[model samples]
Target: MAKHIIAVGAIYIDTILTLPHFPAEDEKLRASKYVRRRGGNCGNAFEVLQQLVEDDIKLHLISVFPNRASADYAFIRDSFKVSVDLSLSIHRDNSQVASSCYVFKSQETDSRTIVNYTELKDMQCHEFIDAVCKLSPAQDAFEGWFHFEGRTPDTLVECVKELRLIPQYSGFKISVELENPSRVGLELVAAEADAVFFSRAWAEARGFKSAVECLKQNMAATKEHALLCCTWGAAGASAVQKDGGEGIWCSVPAWKPELENQSVVDTVGAGDTFIAGMLCGHCCQTSCWSLEQKLKYATDLAGRKVYEEGFAELS
Candidate 1:
């Protein structure tokens, strides 16, 4: 049977400005370059996954967007280079598209500062359930993978609970990303997920010094069969799989660019790229791969992303 991977999150149109340096208070500066692209946690991940997966595995995006007739909606819809099932997406009438503005300072370690604006309402638990119901059918027997961005923790918890109640979704594997540390009740959502992806910023915010330290302390909150991964920027990444009341840990070093003295280009969607790589390794592989392989594949893909401006040529 074929497999299905669905990602649920907000979609944004990103406006990126590359400047020589960040401006000080009341200072004016000219940007060196301007670029616009489709961006979001789920949107970026699906982009990379589209290139990594074969034709057998289908990709789907569950997001909120403006009216179908709007130009913003058209741009987003036409941006995907590969087939991504957006039938499950929700459209809001008389609403503006969610957008983000990023300022990349070339003089300061290739850092970026972002400001976001959105007038569209977030998808509620009922809406999520409705989309899943429309996608699931009695006669279809494809394996399902549901990934949540963990943006709205309360709604996510309810959605997960409702999914568990549906008999048709019993065989589905669910994953959740815990990217924000300040989001209260995210741990509850993580506890319900079969796989959880943690960010380096989240670990430091929670007072954990290392990726392994964070995973080890949080292992008790997950299911016995749960898999946990944490990505540390320059330090590489690590994973801990819970099995038989024990945690199996694996770590891999960060991948550096092959070109000598090549500065990092862009770090905008690196985390999303890493998530897509891990998902690709798990979903597209014919046989089960070791933890080391999974980490390396994801880390290397993300490393490559940093050398380019966008996700176009990462695969």
Candidate 2:
């Protein structure tokens, strides 16, 4: 049986500029490298998982893109066709694809600054449910998993409710990436997710001292069986499983740069890649591995992602 996975979000056209150092506010600077590619939390994760797996699983993506007639949409379609199953995406006429410009400074501590613009509308709950319902006979019969970027919480809740109502989808696992803690309605969405992922920054901004603390505070709002995980860039990753009985907290050290086989160049999409690696582990070894071992595998895989330039390089 082939495992089916779907990632839902908006895809972006990314313009990455690498510089030796960040320029002063009033000064001009030259970029040492420039590249453009398709990126988004879901898209990046899907691409990484696609490259990591062989032919056993089917990777699917449900994203919004400009109409096929648009040059930007054509470019993205052509570029990612070999990497994911985008047949489930939503396209709108006269729509412009979301775009982001990132400036990466290579001096001192490597950091990235991003500015994004979007004209695309958010994905609606019914539209997503409808797309999944319309899957072909073959795809419809397979057991699957869903991963969504946390956006529009109410819509996600409604979508999850609809999915659960389907008799054949009872075994489906739903994971959500809490991309931004500041984003409204996180509590509502987290309560419904089978698994929830967060970032250290998102946790800190909410006045929690650590990811475990943040998750524990919010775990009160989640279902009894919900599991929460958080990723700290250099510090490490942590996970707590709340099974309605007892909660177990576990943490794993992040992969250090000194242990990598390749040279570090870009840190872009590393976190997304981490989500991919974790999801890969979840899909492959759901019952066998301990949470600590899974975290180590994910962190190590993400450590290698930093050595590359873009998500596509994983192939």
Cα error, candidate 1, residue 13 (Å)? 0.5
Among these predictions, the greatest lDDT belongs to: 1
lDDT, candidate 1, residue 8?
97
Candidate 2 lDDT tens digits, 53-132 = 76777888898777878888877777665757878888887775544545455555577777777777778888887788
Clashes of each: 0, 0
Which portions of model 2 show Cα errors greater than 4 Å? 81-83, 96-98, 104-109, 136-140, 258-264, 312-315
Q: Which digits, one per residue and each the tens of the lDDT, describe model 1 over residues 76-163? A: 9999865799989999988755555454556565678777788888999999989988888866655768999979899999999999
Segments of candidate 1 deviating more than 4 angstroms: none
Which pairs clash inside model 1?
Answer: none
| Candidate 1 accuracy as lDDT | 0.88
